[model samples]
Target: MRDVSTLVSKTDELTYKVPVGLKRVPWIETLLLSSEPSIRSIEDTVKLEKAFHDASLFAVKEGYRRLAALNVPAVRPGDFLAETLRDDRTMAKVKAKLADEAARIKAVEDRKRVQAEKKFAKKGANKQQKKKFQQTPEDDDLKNLKTLEQRKDGGYSGKAPKSKAPKSKAPQSKGGRGPGGPKGGKGTKRSDGGKGGVRKSLFKKTSGGGKSSRGKASGRRFKAFFLA
Candidate 1:
C-alpha cells in the first residue's frame, strides 16, 4: 500500500504555472461564435443560465458604448424591428392553451355554483311546504272550541238532520155548506152548476166566430180574479 504521509507530502510540493500577458476573451463573444455545451445535470443547467444572463448584461453595456463611439442609433426604429425567441405561431398556440384552461376553470366554477344553488333551493322549497301544511296551535284551539260550543247548543249532529214532512192543510169552510162541509152539501151543487155556466158563457162570448173576442173575455175574467 502507498504511504499516506508520502502522498500528502507530494501533493503539498506540487506547483501550478500561471501564464502572463494572455489575450482577454469576453464570454459574449465566445458564446456567439459557438453553440453552448450540453448540460448534464440540474446544477450545470443553472450555471449555464447564469452565464447567459451575465453575457446579456455585458452585451447591453458594451453595445451602448460601442454604438455611441460610432455615432450610430442604439434603439430600433420600430417596436416590431425587435425579434422574439419564440415564433408568432408558437406564441399563438400558447395563448390558445391558456384560453382553454381559463374556460375550463370558469365552467367548473359555474357548475359548482349551480349545484349549490339547487341544493339550497330544494331546502327552501321543502321549508315553505312544511309551513303551508303545518297547523298552528291557535287555529287548532279555535276549531276545538267551535265544535264544543255547537255540541252544547244541540246545533250540530254527527250526521245530517232529517227533513220534516210538510203539514197538510184542512179544506177551508165558509159555513156548514162550504167546500169542506158534508159530502152532499150545497157547495158541490154550486160547483157543478158553475162548470155548465162557465161553458155557456164562453160559447156565448165566442158566438161571433173570431178567436179575439174569446181571448178578451178569458183575459178579463183572469184580470178580475187577480184583482180580487
Candidate 2:
C-alpha cells in the first residue's frame, strides 16, 4: 500500500539518491517525434541521447554502467519513448526515477501514477492507427463501481447495490423516459423484465386537453395547460 521508508541524511546519498526524475523535456522529445531514423529496439543507444541530453543525467557513472550491460541498440528520441513504454524493466526504472515525497504514501501514489502512464503509452504505441481511448463521465462511474465491488468483496461491510436491482442481468430503468422510445440513444431505459425502458414515473400523467387533475391524469393533449 505504501513505499516503506526511513529518514535519509547526507550519509545516505548512495541509498537516498533515488533514481532520475521522469519529467518530459520537449527538446529531447524532438528526435522521437520523427518516423525516419527510428529506434529499432528498446535498448537503442542513439535514443539514449535524449536520456543523456542534459549531460548531468547521462553523465552519471551509474547510468553508463547500467546502459553498457543492455543488449538493445541505440534508439532515437521518439523511438526511446515508444520502446521504454513496452519494456517492463524500463517501467521499473521509470518508477525508480521519481522525486522524493516526504510521506511514504505520496511516494507510492506517485509510483502508481507513473506506472499507469507507461501502460497507457504502451497501449497507444501498439495500435498506432487506432483511435485513442478517451476517458468520459461514464467511465468515471464505472471505475467507481468497480472499486466499490472490490472493497465489498474484501470482508468489507457497506451499503449493497440497491435492492430494487433485480438479481438477473435484466436491464433496468435508466433516465427519465418510458419503455417505448428509440431502440437505443441518449437515454436507453431498461426493465426488471429483461427488456429495457425509458425511466418514468408511474402515478404522473396527462388528464386531457385543457383540463387537468393531480393524482393520476389519464388522457391529454400537448397544449397550454401542461404545467411543469
Candidate 3:
C-alpha cells in the first residue's frame, strides 16, 4: 500500500550486491594480462565455471527453474563473476538497476539539502528580528533630517528642531566695582585718583638723577605707579 515515492525512498536504505558494469573493465583487464593465475584461480574461475556448466547440463536434462534462479542466460555460462558481468543482456540489467538506485539516492540527498536550507533560513530570520529589536533609536537631529528626505520637495521646509541653550549665570564682581559689589558700601575709594580721577605720570624726573621712588606709601601698587 506504500506510495511509489515512499518505496523509492526505502530503496535508498536497502543493501544489495552492486551490479558491475564498465567499472569492472579495468579489474578484468588486469586479471587477464597477469603473468600468473590469481590465488583463487581454481576456486573462483574454474569452480564457478564447472558449477555453471553442470547447471546448464542439469537444466537440459531436467528443468529451467534452477537456471532461472541462477539469474544467468543460457546463451553463456560465464567462467567467473566478471565474465558473467560482461554479457550484453546482463550489462543492460545492471545499468537499469544502477540508474534506479542512483535516482533513489539522489532523491534522499535532495530532501536533506532542502531541509537544511529551511533550517538555516529560519535561524537567519530569528537573528535579524533580534538584531532589529536590540538597535537604539536615531538621534532627534538625524530623525528630523530623515523626515525632510520624505517630503515632496526632498528638502527641509519648516524650522529645524532647536536644541536647548545653556542658562547664563551673572558675573561675579571684583574690587567691589559693579552690581555684585559688597552689600555694605558705596565701593572702596581708590588711592590713585578717587573714583573718576586720573594720574598724569609715574616717571616725572626726580631731582636725584631721575631715579624712581614710591610716590606714596599706598597699599595699592598699581594705583601708586599711575599716580606717581
Candidate 4:
C-alpha cells in the first residue's frame, strides 16, 4: 500500500517529484505505472498536458530492456513490435517526424549566421561614418574654433553660415591716441623739420630745435636805478 502521509515536492511547472522509490526506476516500468490509454497528440500535446505522456516516451526509448525484463510479451501496449511491425503508411509518418527535427536544427543555424553578418555590417558602417565626419570642412582648425564659439553661445546644432566676403585689406589701427596723432603732431616739424604739421607747444624746447626764450635773451640785460 502507498504511504499516504508522505510529503511530495511540487515543481513550479505543476509536475510533482517522482516518489523516492519511483525516481530512477526503469523508464519502461514508469510508463506501465501510468494510466494514459495511448500516446497521440491532437495539437502537439506535451507529456504533462496529455496525462502520463512522459511515461510513454520514457518507455518507448527503453522498449527492449523493459520487455526482456518483464518475461512477458504483451504486457505493455507501446511495444517494440508496435512500431517495428507497422505497414508502409506508418513508416512514412516516422520518417516525416525525423525530417521535422532536421529542419528545426537547420533553421537555428541559419538564424545565427544572419545575425552575425548584420552585426559585422553595422560595425563597418560605424567606421565609415566616423571617417566621413573627420573629412568634412567643419573639421578645419579655424572652423573648429568658430564652432567652439558657437557652442559656447548655446547652439545645440553645429551648423553655421560660411563667410564668403573678402578679408579686410587695411591694417588694423592701434588703440589709445597713436603717436603724431589726429590730436597733436610731434615737435620735430617745428624746429628740425620733420614731416607733417606744426609742433606741440609743450615740447618746443626739445633737442635740435630752434632757440627758446632762455636762449633768445643771451646778450640782453635789464638796468636798475637806486636813490640815497
Choose the strongest candidate by TM-score.
Answer: 1
**Per-residue lDDT of candidate 3, residues 1-228 (tens digit):** 759998887888773433586434442232222122224455444344445556555545443444466564555356555654367776576567667767999999999999999999999999999988876666666876678786646565676567799998544322323233454223333555444222222223446675455643243446643443
**On a 0 to 100 scale, what is the lDDT of residue 201 in model 4?**
28
CA displacement after TM-score superposition, residue 129 of candidate 2 (Å) = 7.2
Query: What lDDT score is found at residue 188 in candidate 1?
Result: 29
lDDT of each: 0.60, 0.48, 0.54, 0.54
How would the candidate models be sorted by TM-score, starting from the highest?
1, 4, 3, 2
TM-score of predicted model 1? Answer: 0.32
Residue 27 error, candidate 4, Å: 16
Error of 3 at 159 (Å): 16
Off by over 4 Å in 2: 1-102, 129-228
Model 4 steric clash total: 0
Question: Which candidate number would show the highest lDDT if scored against the true structure?
Answer: 1
TM-score of each: 0.32, 0.13, 0.27, 0.29
lDDT of 4 at 44: 53
lDDT assessment of candidate 1: 0.60
List CA RMSD, all candidates: 16.9, 37.1, 22.2, 21.7
Tell me which of candidates 2 and 3 scores higher on TM-score: 3
Model 2: lowest-lDDT 10 consecutive positions: 219-228
Query: Over all chains combined, what TM-score does candidate 2 have?
Result: 0.13
